[model samples]
Target: MDDPIYDIELEDCPICRGAGLIQDEQGWSVSVACMDCGAETAHAEYRTPEERLEAARRVALLWNMGKVVHTGMSD
Candidate 1:
């Protein structure tokens, strides 16, 4: 679980370089955390309750059939 955030960042994810996923050793496959903000190729940090709610709303809209599809999604 993530704590609420305030500041929103548009920076590249250092972990995935804003790719929103990590690739396999052979680069044949990739997977997303499906929880982190950067999974959308953009990230938001909600430090406050309001911001957290906003983030949650955004997350809710990302679901397809109640399942998150984060891999290969980029801005």
Candidate 2:
């Protein structure tokens, strides 16, 4: 099977840089372990409205491609 194409705009993972996981800091009173690299941060932000719309279009294209693959295999 082919891998799913990630054609949409995606923010880079700050901790792992697309490695998908990261280590957490210690010594805090209520500290939590970082299991994933894509945790939301105060400095992190999203794209603008127009950029988001373009990303939506790309996502739709990929979703339709997935549906085609599903139906083709089931038939």
lDDT of each candidate versus the true structure: 0.36, 0.29
| Candidate 2, position 27, lDDT | 18
Q: Candidate 1 at 12: error in angstroms?
A: 30
- Residue pairs in clash, model 2: none
Candidate 2 local lDDT, 1-75, one digit each (tens): 331223333433433333211112231111111134333221111255454444344433433332111111121
Top TM-score prediction, candidate number: 1
Give the residue spans of candidate 2 off by over 4 A. 1-46, 67-75
For model 2, the local distance difference test gives: 0.29
Per-residue error (Å), model 2, residue 20 = 25
Name the 10 consecutive residues with the lowest summed lDDT in model 2: 25-34
Task: Give the deviation of candidate 1 from the true structure as CA RMSD.
Answer: 13.4
In the range 16-72, model 1's lDDT, one tens digit per residue, is 443223212122222223344434322334555565556544543333123343454
TM-score, cand. 1 vs. native: 0.29
